[model samples]
Target chain A: MSTAERTAVTATRTRGLRRILRPRARLWLGTLAAALILFVVAPAALSGYQFGLLAQFLCYAMVAVGIGLAWGQGGMLTLGQGLFFGIGGYAMAMHLQLDDAGPGGVPAFMSLYGSGTVPAWWEPFRDPWITIGTIILLPAALAALLGYAIFARRVRGAYFAILSQALVAAFAILLIGQQASTGGSTGLSNFRGFFGYSLADPLNQRLLFFLAAGTLIGMVLLVRLLMRSRYGELLVATRDQEMRVRFLGYNPALVKTVAFVVSSVFAAVGGALFVPIAGIISPSDVAVVPSIMFVAGVAIGGRATLLGPVLGSLALSWVGAQLQDNYPSVWSYFQGALFVLVLGFLPQGFATLGGVLRRRKGDSR
Target chain B: MTTTRPLALEVTGLRVEFDGFVAVRDVDLTVPAGELRFLIGPNGAGKTTVIDALTGLVRGTGTARFDGHELLGRPVHRLVRAGIGRTFQTASVFEGHTVLQNLDIAAGLHRRPTTLLRRRRGVPEEVLRALDTVGLDDLADRPAGELAHGQKQWLEIGMLLVQDARLLLLDEPVAGMSGEERAATGELLRRISRDRTVVVVEHDMEFLRNYADTVTVMHRGSILAEGGVDEVQSDPRVIEVYLGAPLDAPTATATARATGRETR
Candidate 1:
């Protein structure tokens, strides 16, 4: 054969061979690559400060996963994920502060800022097991109740978004108003340890980062299963044709409630982890702004895709940090411009890049 | 088309009102098992309201029984579980999903919650069979939104087929169809009614004359007449209501009244 023809024949053979791996195999391979970067490359490459910042972004990414499910798939448009995040964050923070206080003593901030006596509500969090359990269950229960109420009334779209935003605002203001129990506006912070591990130790900090990374990956896998499962189809179906789904013998409200609760639980778990990693739990984190930021991250990532929220969160955070360091005065405007560009030009976000490239190629041909 | 053991539906004193204005008033309807019944009426006739009551989409005062289960006062999904289903004027398929996925979701009425979590296994025989029944097997993998108008309607009927919905209430299934599409839809409905009971709310007079086994004419939210095609068509009252002409007056005078002036 001529050399050009021979090379073309070999290329065709290799392409056919590679197609044998299939989508399922490709997914597993992609996941392995991500895990390697997160667990090994990230730790080996970055300074401790930058590494900690990445860990913080992962927590936000976790929140984005739940937002993707509830808002992206279920069409909920929840603007108050920070409320659930705060619930979990405060739950963990209370326990950490109580543990540091030793036995029945009050946290230093509480004694300094408010009444010396610990409130009755703060007592249950003193037990680490109860704290952990509450961290998981409280947000889910609240979400279930709140989701049922709103969805049952068929309140959605901008109204649901507005209500969720109002809720986070109220929650933040409530924390600020309560001086004695919640440390007023300053909120909860300065944990000496995490479940008996010294935060001062570099080894423990790395371990916490790993925990956050593993949790984020686990959540992505879980939501993957949900999206592939019948429940996932039903969730998307519910989003599109809620009334029709009702006539299909599925309770649309119940279907929606499950998505809402699951998403809220994810946010809560992210919040719970945030306490140990970021060493703070304040109203500032749980207010309306951070919750909206969670949404922006997911939207920029391609909300419906499995890993879009994670990648989106990481990318947005990295860029935001770089801009803040360099531009300082106009960093916020750059971020706003980024949101407009992504949401306007690429409504489905970065996940559609492959499809766009393929389409362009097809058009050329 | 696969044959299903259709359920019978009976309603008595079924009344529906929107804020003190009665849309459907004390109406009585009985559709026997495996009968293809057509409900025809004018603009304000409330033929669709009766369906709304039956499907639990609206609150009605009286009882609507499907087979042995009570339909009224129950949630819509519960009524669906009780073997009742309906299609809408506007297409309601999950437009993003493939044709096969749409049917699979409908056929999964009996699936357990835990089973819903796992990825769907191999396609069930029922789903594959429904695909062929609706003649959408070729487009099984195509997104539902991509289907043409008639094809979308057929896919909807296919969904009800696998849902195993015994009593099917179709609203304007051929609203925007060409003659050819109408004939195909008519043929499909005929095949469906061989086993399953069907109530179709329609406005196309030609489609009705061709396909209706029994027709119930409704006027002003009440049953005006009920019988075979020719019987209702010949009734003077029916002709008068449809043409808006006075039966007792002379033809010339009736024409004059139409223009609001005396012809004589």
Candidate 2:
């Protein structure tokens, strides 16, 4: 055949295949199927301890998705999501402790701190529904307010990043100082039940694992949907060129603020789930170190690509857990080395591998 | 064709300083509705500074009234909302979006409601009409960054057209166009100026000669001459400051002899 005829045939076949496959739908379906299998089927096969670890990793992955949206896409470089995460975790932790203590009983931490009475601020957390709802909404509302104050004045880039980091530092310090109610450096732990269900029971543990897995899948789908919408286009535009987006009549500050808040809420939900699965809440989990770990996973996964952050976080957390268990002395250094290697060699993250393969295929065709 | 209404843009004693260096100094100008005016000068003559000040991109101490609203301290987006649209010297089309999406964003500003539940109509027919006017309707689906230089320039103009601003500020609208593209741009401007006011900053003399009803000349951050194109071209101060000293002896004589004509 002539070159023209061959080209025409190739084009026809490509179009026919595109029509039959519907690339976007296929991707969605494939992702959903994979997540279902990973959450439902894989956990069933693993030991109880392994399932619990997966549950913890899923929570971390949820936070990673939020970081991907805020720092990766919106270019906010937020290093303080841990503050919001801790807020949700502590809120839920307080409620869980109260439920374990029974009516009119003080938490064990309050007794150790000095006062035999629960603080007035901790009163609202007694309601399970309120605590659960606050875990989702409180951090988002606070983020919205903070984002509006900073971004509206056009504070961005490194200055915004430093400000967010400072907030996290202050939060950790505050938690450390509050020995009575907050559990200080050690943090609140040794919970017995959540909403009247015994935490020690194997069934409750499995249920919490499923909840975390379901929550992770749901959060990923929500982000995917948002990123595919027109608002997502506006968000990317705002990130690329705020001046141009402004000239196009969009208030870039407002758009960025909304995205930041939504991301914060996602992180908060992850943190809330994290406490129940891990059976503990501590300053170590919501400190600057963990915040950096959150960003490292996103960078290693490819910040712009969907599913990269989730998978990257899961893989990195799994490795971290394993190395710490097997070689406790060098695990931290090893994780740091991994970040350095990824940054030095694969700055676009592992997602670019797929793009390269596709390009090669196109060239051959 | 003068109306009782004042000009769309009236600037008097406009002065803009950047770190104590005056970019636009004591310049006065006016552009009437339905008229195409050009501000022409050599490089560093403050043409773009004037555009920036008018668009509120730069702060200026001047009396700039557009449809009777003060523009000196207002923000750029607010200026656009007040019926003043502008295109940048370097084309400002969104690189990641399609040409149609860029225009839709420009037009979408006027269509936003108080709530998010409202359905936003995609690229109205008027936007398509604007693209057709600039001969870029077929390239609507293409990413804007992939378009040719001249086509991107036209697309920027199309964005301004779809904005439907009462007063349009176009900075170097035909800066990188070919001969055909430049002529097409001139035609497009002429067609657009029938229902709106236009203030264009251009360095292309031929383009100014073809389209400008009035030409404002600037030198050293101030208006040196304002009149018809021929009047500004013949102004001695403008020629001396902008066109440079007359080519003496060998150069002039050589050009005259080559063309078989007397030196001016």
Candidate that scores best on lDDT: 1
The candidate scoring highest on DockQ is 1
Per-residue lDDT, model 1, residue B22, is: 87
lDDT of 1 by residue, B1-264 (tens): 245466778888988989999898878888888788999887778998888888988899888888889888998888888778899988889999999889888877877778888888889888898888889999999999999999999999998888888899999899999999999999999988888889999887778889999898887878888888767766666666777433223532443354444223
lDDT of 1 by residue, A207-245 (tens): 999999999989988888899899999999999999988
On a 0 to 1 DockQ scale, where is model 1? Answer: 0.77
Residue-level lDDT of model 2, residues B73-153, one tens digit each, is: 888778877777788888878888888877776776766534222323466876878889889989989999999888988
For all candidates, the clash counts are 0, 0
Docking class of 1: medium
TM-score (chain B) of candidate 2: 0.87
Q: Clashes in model 2: which pairs?
A: none
Chain A TM-scores for all candidates read: 0.93, 0.91
Query: Which residues of candidate 1, in runs, are more than 4 Å off?
Result: A1-20, A360-365, B1-5, B244-264
TM-score each candidate. Answer: 0.92, 0.89
Off by over 4 Å in 2: A1-20, A360-365, B1-7, B113-123, B245-264
Task: Give residue A5's error in model 1 in angstroms.
Answer: 27
